[model samples]
Target: MMKIIYTLFSCLIFTSCFNIERNCNDYKTGTFQFNYMEDGVEKTGKFVRTEAYSIDYFEGKIDSSSVRWINDCEFILTNLHPKSNQEKRSIHMKIISTSKNSYTFEYKYAVKEGNRPDRVVKGIAKKIE
Candidate 1:
């Protein structure tokens, strides 16, 4: 029993020390492709991001958003020209993990409204340029 407990503790310590790679700065300003499912259809969107702004091209329309970085791994994005009430809300985004050419991120509305619960969506983006 003592040996088993020691082995389990050692495993936990080793796993805790492992960290995911996050070279966020390298992804701060780039063109990237994100694939998602919408209405049961797989869709791809491309976006160009700078330090302060981002332009997204999706479904034959271009939308722009202003970006404010809270840190190297997190930021908030506000739509520049929102056509609906929901679009006017700011989105909070965080990079959960990263790789050589892609990063996994989660985003949600920054502010809760009405009785709707906050919803977080996670996706992976691949750098294209």
Candidate 2:
């Protein structure tokens, strides 16, 4: 029992000391690239984000969204010209971890739906410029 307790305590202490690096400020205003799957096909998209807005280019279409910062590591993105009701919803984005020129983020709809749990998606974006 003592040996097991010591092992568990050591693991808890080691994990508490490990911290993920988040340099979200470095990615606030830059061009970034990411990949996503749609209809079982993989596609790549590029976006340019400023402090107040973000413009995305996918395929030949362009979409714009407003950026409302919640903090240095989190923000809300609302479509500027939503074409449908689903598109009108705002997405909450949180930067989970970051490297020198890239970041891993999780995002989901800001508003919850009736009787349904929120679906969060994680992705990585690499800064291009």
Candidate 3:
């Protein structure tokens, strides 16, 4: 019995399967910041969640287009208008684990292929007044 239960638990964790009510209430609704490592360099940014579904980002002499939430933890960023064939890409962020004031998140864009196709973004955000 113990062996069977352990095997099932291992399978679930390794499969990246999440089934929890991490609703909008659990996510912070205010300004936050994160440092991203891109191209072997680090970039810092300040992000704001105006409401449950709206966002704006700025930091380190850089500001980005508005972002909006699609679901509880998922968000879409439109950096550019509908120019040519691309209409801007979407970024999906999910809370993999959390404490009271912080959460571990993973981010990825919907794409076909590349090295590290699934890039995990570990961010720690704090709520502000």
Candidate 4:
């Protein structure tokens, strides 16, 4: 019947979505820049990870902040002096596309405001050697 057809159709879509290959270890090493949009302005920054466990994320002209990763794709960005909401921005970066010399990543910036949800940013980073 129609009901049987609808149920089977929905299951096909759901299963396909869950099958994408997601291994974070292969996608995590590089120097990346944030071409993220904040308050309708494009903000730029550089993130340098000497290895998998250590990184220095820098913004503006010359000031840089060091951060550490929990794993290949997840890391905590922190600031020492602590000013504005930038100090506590919870960032999660996931790889979407990869090639010989670059990768496209999708990221979400968690918000603390009660009325709004997290903001998502996506960009491609070229590998630096």
Candidate 5:
């Protein structure tokens, strides 16, 4: 029993020491491609981001957003021209992890609406240029 406990403790210690690499600065301003599901279809979208702005091309529509960096790994994105009530809400995004040419992110509404629960979505984006 003591040997088993020691082995389990050693495993836990090693696992807890593992960390995900994140180099957010490399992705701060670049062109990126993301693949996601929309209406039962998998689609790819591209976006170009500068320090303070981002332009997204999706579904043949070009939309722009203003970006405010909260930190090196997080930012708030507000649509420049919202067409609907849902679009008016700003999104808060954080870089969860990153690899050599890609990063994983999680995003959700920046401001909660009434009693509605906030929904967070995660995706991976690859830097294209």
Candidate 6:
């Protein structure tokens, strides 16, 4: 039992030392591209972000959203001109890890209603400019 406990403790220590790199500041204000699946088809979208707003171009449709940063790695996006009740909802996004030109992120609806489960989706965005 002692040997088993020692091995488990050592494994936990080593794994805890491994950390994911998050250089979210480098991607705060830039043009980025990401892919998403729509009706079983893969589609790519691009967006331009500044300090206060983000403009997205997808399938010839343009959308603008307000950007509110919670911290260096987290932000909330609210549509500036929501077309429907669903669009009025805000999204919460977090930067999990980053590479040289891309960052992995997870996003979900910012607010939840009673009896509704949370659904988070992860994606990678590559900086273009």
Among the numbered candidates, top lDDT falls to: 5
Single out the weakest 10-residue window by summed lDDT for candidate 1: 19-28
Which regions of candidate 1 fall more than 4 Å away from where they truly are?
1-14
Kindly list the per-residue Cα lDDT of model 1 for residues 76-125, writing each as its tens digit: 99999999987999999999989999999999998888798989999999
| Residue 62 Cα positional deviation in candidate 5, in Å, after optimal superposition | 0.4
Candidate 6's TM-score: 0.91
| Residue-wise C-alpha lDDT for candidate 5, range 84-108, written one tens digit per residue | 9999999999999999999999999
Q: After superposition, how far is residue 70 of candidate 5 from its true place, in Å?
A: 0.4
Model 3 TM-score (2 dp)? 0.55
Off by over 4 Å in 3: 1-24, 38-43, 52-68, 80-87, 111-116
In terms of lDDT, which candidate is stronger, 1 or 4?
1
lDDT for each candidate structure? 0.95, 0.97, 0.60, 0.61, 0.97, 0.97
C-alpha positional error of residue 64 in candidate 1 after TM-score superposition, expressed in Å: 0.2
TM-score of each: 0.88, 0.90, 0.55, 0.55, 0.89, 0.91
Worst ten-residue run, lDDT, model 5?
13-22
RMSD of 2: 2.3
Tens-place lDDT digits, model 4, residues 73-99: 665545444467665565565676566
Between candidates 1 and 4, the TM-score winner = 1
